[model samples]
Target: MSRQEFLVDIVIALPSDLPPERRAELVAAESARARELRAAGSIQRIWRRPGQTANVGVWVAESATELHDLISSLPLFPWMSVRVGALARHPLEDDHQ
Candidate 1:
């Protein structure tokens, strides 16, 4: 099946009582996994909201189920509050070439 696009907004809220070292470890692993997804084309674009623990990204997957699986693969998924929207091709973006 052809891939579909999804827009994702995520806020990572680790408990304030969580140990700093554990937070660091999860962050490190999350970064590595995100890189892998990007290389694999699952992550199309990503941006961080400055001065916040949040990010927005465009992702590609075969289906919403696939998208969920991909996002859940992140090491910090359990600590994330996320929103995802399916994206549709813009009429102005038609490729006739």
Candidate 2:
């Protein structure tokens, strides 16, 4: 089967007075989601900056719909605001050359 990929970037608008404990909890929950994705072998890599305003991750899936479903499965989906920068596939070498 051919590998599919998406490039996603998220920017978070953090709430004021967000406590450290709550932040930790949110992170823990997100980590669990990541673990699940890893177990399913769909996630390619995840890059996160806790103290910053954004996190980025790459996902490999069978289709774009699958990627959407995967993102919806994350706990952060409800409250966490995000902006998807780009969602596209890289050109195959044969196709490009």
Candidate 3:
């Protein structure tokens, strides 16, 4: 099946009282997983929001269910507030895959 494009926005809000060591561990794990996804083409692009623990990415998957699974696989999933939106090509734009 062909993949679909999705705009993903994520904000990670860790508990204030959580141990610093555990926070670092979680962040490192999330970074590693994100790298793997990028290498596999699931993450087309990602941009971090300045002054905030947030990011937006262009992602791809065969279906919304699959996309959800992929996002949920992140180590920081439990601490993240995420929003996903499907994307479609604009009529006036050059062909985009």
Give me the candidate number with maximum lDDT.
3
Q: Write the per-residue lDDT of candidate 3 for residues 12-62, one digit (tens) a residue.
A: 999999999999899899999999999999999999999999999999999
Most accurate candidate by TM-score: 3
Q: Is candidate 1 or candidate 3 better by lDDT?
A: 3
Candidate 2 lDDT, tens digit per residue, 4-92?
A: 77777766664668798887797788779879997887777778878886677777877777777888787667656655443555578
The clash count of every prediction, one per candidate, is 0, 0, 0
Worst 10 residues of 3 by lDDT: 88-97
lDDT of each: 0.95, 0.73, 0.96
Question: After aligning candidate 3 to the native by TM-score, how far in Å is the CA of 58 from where it should be?
Answer: 0.4
Give me the runs in candidate 2 sitting further than 4 Å from their true place.
1-3, 17-24, 49-51, 81-97
lDDT comparing candidate 3 with the true structure: 0.96
Model 2 residue 90 distance off true place after TM-score fit, in angstroms: 6.1
> Please, what is the TM-score per model?
0.93, 0.64, 0.94
Candidate 2 lands at a TM-score of 0.64
lDDT of 1 by residue, 2-92 (tens): 9999999999988999899998899899999999999999999999999999999999999999999999999999989999999987877
